[model samples]
Target: MDRVIIAGGGWSGCAAAVQAKKEGADVTLLERTDMLLGTGLVGGIMRNNGRFTAAEEMIAMGGGELFQVIEENLKHKHISFPGHEHGDLYDIGKISGAVFRFLKEMGIHIYTKSRVLHAQMKDRRMINVTDAEGNCYSGDGFVDATGTAGPMNNCSKYGNGCAMCILRCPSFGGRVSLTSLAGVQEKMGRRPGGAVGSMSGSCKLYKESLSLEIQERLGRDGVAVVPVPPELVEDHLEKKSCQQYALPEFRENLVLLDTGHGKLMTPYFPLEKLQKIPGFENARYEDPYAGGKGNSMRYFAMAPRDNTLNVEGVDNLYCAGEKSGLLVGHTEAIVTGVLAGHNCVRRIQGKQQIILPDTLAIGDIISYVKQEMDTPEGMERKYTFSGSFYFQRMKEKGLYTTDTALIQKRVEEAGFSRYFSHSGKKDCVS
Candidate 1:
């Protein structure tokens, strides 16, 4: 019953809360916005490319509740899109509520609209975190899943002006980094050209805004690929946070996915230009009201952490999601969050923390990203299991696989079968 306070209730924070609860810790998840799944509120893609293997690996390790929730709420499964295959698009409209309910059912206290603005530290350990309302949340250990999305200033300084993406920083106050608050020096991810932050790839479009032809194609096949006119195509691929989707096909065609709302595959398309395309005459953005301009900027503040996700130079704080590194995607966040949560609890109990072995893709990426981030070149790249350089590395290292049984065996061999499910409670919260 050790108290574990988690900041930023995105996918990673939710995953950490669940795993920490399973490890017999009293968990409290604080989110800046009113809803769960920060940037993930707009993102619906899962089980695509190497993510399929990564998801199965987490399931085998007994940390699959979130994935199960996603699977149950999936709108389309095993569908293929440009540069991605065997993908699952969860209902973005339904997923946030579903995940929130799942965490509550597991006995984790959730406080939305509660943004942690300051941290009280004693020596090297965090004593408590004070929310915007001055409410103090004290914990034995903490996890910072507060992702690297933005606080308006970063977006305006780095990319185009605020696109009003799902993070809704304008409404809930900008993302405040717990690691930075605790006196730890954080890092910023950069584009290849050394820009400060990367633009959020993919924007959501109102389904009804699209024409009948494109709508029908998306409904039937879960994806619609319309060729973009040569003159209308805008190339913003290199500035994309999700480099996995930066492809010639994405530039040449308007690839839309059925995620309740239409998931536009580019970061942001000009509204005027989008209207010129066939079947998109009435296209309008659903998430970023200003999708015609730009999307949310991400990777502005990332915490330096070890492979176990413990924030370096801090005794009682752990970090996950984008805070853990330049890692993107919901699956990456969930996996890192699970490990961080479990390890945080173990640290509280004075037990040795566990790190997944390189035999599995999850472990490999965590260790590999930490190693790569030490160099200047690695900071310029974004990592995700879906696609991009990491996906290519997965293929080269034989870590990318669609076979569930193979991933399960790898997890079992790593001695992590039901690792997050060990239960021994002492009511340390009082």
Candidate 2:
């Protein structure tokens, strides 16, 4: 009852492990590659738009361990970019080590290079999981945070092939879903015209390769927007997975954020064309190494789950991050991860698992994304707190706010102020 095994060590999986450990469980986290954080290695944007409200909500909810780390490591704070405001960017170069140290200090068992490829289930509950190395791991509960990116095959079929982003599919093998391995039928997201998956909306560039002016500007402002000449602008927004960044401003300019590496906000920009733009003359792709063509693909496989984050048809299986519906962004993933991990322990404890009341932003999104993901139209779009439809909805519902004290009060009003702070006798209060 005290053991939990979580597959995948991205931001969500890491958060899940943290919550499970805090719940007094012996947690074991398995990651596919040599390092952790997965796509988070290339992602550093935080607190932009409704994300500010969501982050504050989580902090007040007692799920702020990771958020604290992120804030401490942010290279730039309170910055703005095209279609986004009050954003912060973490130093990608230092984040992996910092997060790794935190997890280790918490005494969570972390096994890198442990890609879970198989699972053994008894009745409706998972008994154990086996990594690609043939090592078996058993626990009282399980979580599938293995994200929805590619394994080479899906990218080639659905995207412009693998842009070789941070997932490092070839080196460590692509992502393998624990939900699918448990004999559950998984769902795949589709594009507007019935395409299989969506292309990742961003790529990393070597900052040193940029012109002195651009580099200096990024250092000073954390964002550098250079207008793309009319002819140099290539329209790949249709293929972008991050609908949040698919604004006209993104295409009108080459928006770069300082996340250690220059984060280019586009599915992929052709190098030859990108070079034609004024300061990007010496620009180079850091990740994927072929940003000229495309980037990593996502939303290939999602697990069907309830608002409580339990995988349907499985008694002790839970999911988070991209595996949990079409929810995107680190904020979205981290919150879902906390819920799934907490619920896994609650289920094993034989307590009635709790669902966040939609009064709070985190809770609302948990239920909203699940409901939206059920329709044909909903499957075509990505949901995040940062921007686009979901963010708009947050504002309309009075769920979006940046006031820290107000967010704490809102969580208190939702009756989950410290729900994740420690094990609870009841759902709302510990």
Give the per-residue lDDT digits (tens) of candidate 2, residues 85-197: 99999999988889999999999999999999889999999999999899999989999999999979888888788787788888999889999998888998998898889
Candidate that would win on TM-score? 2
Local lDDT at 95 for model 1: 96
Each prediction's whole-model lDDT (CA): 0.91, 0.90
TM-score per model over all chains: 0.98, 0.98
**lDDT of candidate model 1 versus the reference:** 0.91
What candidate 1 gets wrong by more than 4 Å, as runs, is 423-430
The digit string of per-residue lDDT tens for model 1 on 1-430 reads 6999999999999999999998878999999999999888999999999999999999988889899999999999899987899999999999999999899898999999999999999999999999999999999999999999878998899989988887888888999989999989899888897878999989899999999988899999999999999999899899999899989999999999999999999989999999999888988899798999998998988898888899999988999998999999999999999999988998999977777889889999999999999999999998999998999999999999998888878877777766665544332211
